[model samples]
Target: MQEHIRQLFSENIQTMIAAGESLSGPLENAAFVIVNNLVSGGKVICVGEGATSALASHFCQLLLDQFETERPCLPALALCNQNNSLQHSHQQDYLARQIKALGQSQDVLLVVSSSGSEPSLIKAVEAALTNDMKIIALTVDGSGELSGLLNQQDVELKVPAHRRARIFECYTFLLHTLCELIDMTLFPQQGDL
Candidate 1:
């Protein structure tokens, strides 16, 4: 039992290490996209399902509230709900519909998924594309459908691990790192705040 617990932690740490090596450049690019969007009077829309949904809400709250220091709230929305009826509606495009209604050109769309194959998330990507928004996809792998939809303008932060737990763990770390980078970039003089 103790060895099993240790293995889980070890695996998570390994995954994070690998991600840190590969994702640094992409994450920086993502932060640049998000910060540029906010500076240009655009907002960020995040969408995910299941456990990823909760992470989406958390990310939005982090942006709308605070990450470390006190600063002006940023515009971020989470199209997340655990309720399958709303998330996986008959059309399986509920997030896409929401994006179409609220998303605008220059906005940032942050899509979180364990696998990039989720139909609803793919639709959301399509809507974001239609709206001319930038995309930052957080997924375990880029070999799925969502990867194909991303263009040169979009950023893909793929976790190095395939295990759900490890991927989710890396995601949380990645999101927090992004928040920190954004704060530092946007509030260079306000770090003590």
Candidate 2:
């Protein structure tokens, strides 16, 4: 079992390393946008559905908490927080409303949607766009309908994995890598490894 586990980890790491090279440039650009926006007093908002919500929360927390980055505690919110007092439809409405309430024009919205086509997801994306917020999407190659909404030049990062579990695993790996890269870029001796 341990050997099998090690193998799994090794394979995953290799896949992520490949994905990293393909995505590094865009991820850096996204991080730059995020850092600049925060410096200008804007918040970072993350939105997703189902498991991607978990990813969003994890990414948001990591960005806000990692000490090496030395970044201020910028306002970061996960729209999928169950405790957020909004119904599904209301939450959809609130995404745009919340952005307007909390986000500045240059603020960043990192939207992680493997499928990307969920109504709530679409609603949130629309809201982000309407608010003139910069967006960074971490998604899958043929994530079907969801892929359609994403603009290739819009800080979009896509993994080649097609299966949901594969996509989810790769998504988390890529996001963590981006965060690590950002931290390294911002603070050269941050011990990112």
Candidate 3:
């Protein structure tokens, strides 16, 4: 059992290393977009489905609270925390409505989907586009529908793996990296301590 567990950890680490090599540029660009939006007094809206919902909420929490060092609270919201009625709504139109109502041209919309084919997430992306918000998608390879939807203006950090669990694990690291980058950019004096 211990050997199996060790193998799993080793495989996951290898996947993460491969993801880092391929996604570093896109991740950095996404961080820049997020930092620039916040610096300009814009907000960040995060949305996701299933396990990714937790990640979306965590991203918002880290930004609204703090990731590492002391700094002013950044504006961020996670759509996954919507009321139960919205969560249970038919076809998740409520989420799309919320985005349409709250999203602004200057805001950034961060969407996470391992499969990159959740209908609700796609709707949220459409609403964000209608509102002229920038989009940053964290998804895995072979994300056909989601990849097709992204335009030149959008940033897609498509991890090189196909398994959902592996993609999500990579996302966890990417989120931490994003927070660190934001802190470093905003507070260079902190020195990443």
Give the winner by lDDT.
1
lDDT of each: 0.89, 0.73, 0.85
For each candidate in turn, give its C-alpha RMSD to the true structure in angstroms: 2.1, 3.2, 1.8
Question: Clash pairs of candidate 3?
Answer: none
TM-scores, each model vs. reference: 0.93, 0.79, 0.93
Cα lDDT of model 3 by residue, 115-149, tens digit: 87788888888888899999999988888587778
Q: Residue 104, candidate 2: how far off, in angstroms?
A: 2.4
Candidate 2 lDDT, 7-122, residue by residue in tens: 87877777677777888787778777776776677777887777888899998887778734565454677765344666666755555566667665777888898776676677
Error of 3 at 102 (Å): 0.2
Q: lDDT per residue, candidate 1, 20-104, as tens digits?
A: 9999999999999999999999998999877888888899999999998989999999995334665334457778888999999
Output the TM-score of candidate 3: 0.93
